[model samples]
Target: MTRRWTHGRSMRHSGAACGATSAQARITDEAHLVTCPDCPDAAEAEAIPDDATTGDPHLIETLRDARDGHTRKIDGVVVDATTAHAILTVYDAATPKTKAKIAVLPLTVMTSLAWNILRADVKREGPR
Candidate 1:
């Protein structure tokens, strides 16, 4: 039995009843599977969202964060992370007196396995 999707006076598809228009349906169909990267047959060129933007403080921090907990200790510099997660401090070559506090980030967009790997410290390096 075919079902109709009618929004106004016009009758849409007579098979599947969907709220989105035909273009949206197409886009959704073509959309790449995010956080499920194991599908090797999936499209390689599709674009999607990542965890953060380039200017996001946390984004830059993650790149240079204390890898495995090795404190980035600079003399006369007191690093303090008041939040639940720890943050690393980066010193500027341009300004010897300035520091940037880059905080630990949340894993919002990663796959389950990737998140696990980030959280787990097995065969760990650096800080205890």
Candidate 2:
């Protein structure tokens, strides 16, 4: 028999019970068993789509510029000017930690998206 589990439901494993909300649940072959993606027994790492980053020309150029540090101030916000696309807001000029923020934003956004084109790609194809 197949059992379906809903979000916010609890499942027991190894005499220990755990509950997972919708966002914390991961899809698995065993419908009766819901596991968190971070759990040790969860599914293997997902494969990244090869074209995830290079799918859009504009996104690619913006990413390259940010990577090469061709940054400047535009309207009080730090922006990458390599392609003149102004897609990424590296930091705000008013911030005291502008330099530190610039270094951190790219790393954080590298794991996430800083602009719409990249986000759209991820939404369409799923995360990398």
Candidate 3:
């Protein structure tokens, strides 16, 4: 028996009930996923797991540490995958001209980090 159609549910749920995927379903508001039980579970089931961190304990540990409110670190230096990903996502979605402006961000970040480290070392050495 078909589940009776409801007003607030996503088209994805409606599609599922009717046994067809809808492109319209793909574009529906994300909030529906939160309020609609079946769609949320199906969406969770359909989500692709990040494979890079899946088997690597070190990467998993870093992500866990980040999620737990500690800044992520690799080789004892603070780094943030989340921020890096946000930057990359913007770059990827940018127009060509915008991409040109964004392309140097990683290098700029590295240069700033290096300069800060140098300044800290000079301060630690204390007038030598």
Candidate 4:
């Protein structure tokens, strides 16, 4: 029987869990992780660098949609908001050469969704 995700249920048993290494939930299936909206492994795979001066908190503040828990979808798949915000932080911090590499990723689809969020934030923040 193929299991479908129930909206109200937790994703802990959905074969989509991440960061927990017990053996069973380690999830080596790359394809499912790629497609699963709530997959934290996918978010971790994107891997944002921890640079002290990246100005991420400001950027995070600027992403009001992410703060509000709004959904950002990529190819009809809903992206976790914290993950999306983290991606935006990566984008904001990347160097020109590094950004070129990141811009072509499937995960970069979040950038499009983020554009609207950013514009709205800019409007609210008032006159950058």
Candidate 5:
């Protein structure tokens, strides 16, 4: 005897009860397979609560405070104090072109200048 199959019954036989609204059905020698391109994979689908916080204001504020509190130092000398003072002093005394050049000095050279200034090796003369 032969049996006739309907579309819904065939979908049920394929073991895909998730619904066939946007699914593609394929028949293989071993079994029938139904795959939906829009559906997320079973292992990757995670349930998130409606009240879950995507971005916490308190966490953002804490991170900003931590970043602000961070003090950058090179060889035990503070970059903001010694290096900044020397740069500002020179910038104030420099011509417009020279001031522009001083603005782009790399961090390594700036730190070296700071080290020299702290050691009294770099001398500051009267404004020219």
Candidate 6:
């Protein structure tokens, strides 16, 4: 008998319960994580067709749609990252953006700060 998830959009296709492949189960689990109350989310619904180089040709479009649909609506954490394209859009003023895309630009920055904070070990404390 096939075990199934009855709640969300997908109809389960697996037969065995305990022996379902770990990788498949994980994919299904991730699909559930991306589910939307209004519509299908990343893993639940269709996305860009796979490409040879990046595996999803329309990945950028998909990400843009998701970001536009976000719930909390924070101010300007990210905006479309093009200048030439911005000329045609309403966000032209928000464009020619910076490249501060990473969560933390450098992990060791704290170590540098810590060293700078020590006042060079009092200068006279070092042996000759």
lDDT of each prediction vs. the true structure?
Answer: 0.29, 0.37, 0.44, 0.47, 0.38, 0.30
Relative to the unseen true structure, what is the C-alpha lDDT of residue 71 in candidate 2, on a scale of 0 to 100?
A: 47
The TM-score of predicted model 2 comes to 0.22
Off by over 4 Å in 6: 1-3, 6-54, 70-128
Give stretches of model 2 more than 4 Å off.
1-67, 80-114
lDDT of 4 by residue, 1-128 (tens): 44332211123244334334344444343445333455544444323332211223333343446435864334323456666666666677668896665555554454654465567767999975
Q: Which one wins on TM-score?
A: 4
| Clash pairs (backbone) in predicted model 4 | none
Clashes of each: 0, 0, 0, 0, 0, 0
All-Cα superposition RMSD per candidate: 16.5, 15.7, 16.6, 13.2, 22.4, 15.1
lDDT of 3 by residue, 1-128 (tens): 42223222233245453233555544344444344455554444334233223224344344445545665443323445654444444545668896565444343453354455556767999995
Per-residue CA lDDT of model 1 for 1-128, tens digit only, reads 33222222112233222233443332223224222232221222112123344235554353344344433222112122321122221222213333222222232222233334444644466467
* Candidate 2 accuracy as lDDT: 0.37
Best by lDDT: 4
* Runs of candidate 5 exceeding 4 Å displacement: 1-78, 111-128
Between which residue pairs do clashes occur in model 5? none
TM-score of each: 0.20, 0.22, 0.23, 0.32, 0.29, 0.19
lDDT of 2 by residue, 1-128 (tens): 54334332123232222344343353344644554434432222122112213223344344556447754322222344432332344332225575344433433353343345445656999757
Ranking by lDDT: 4, 3, 5, 2, 6, 1
- Candidate 5: worst-modelled 10 consecutive residues by lDDT: 43-52
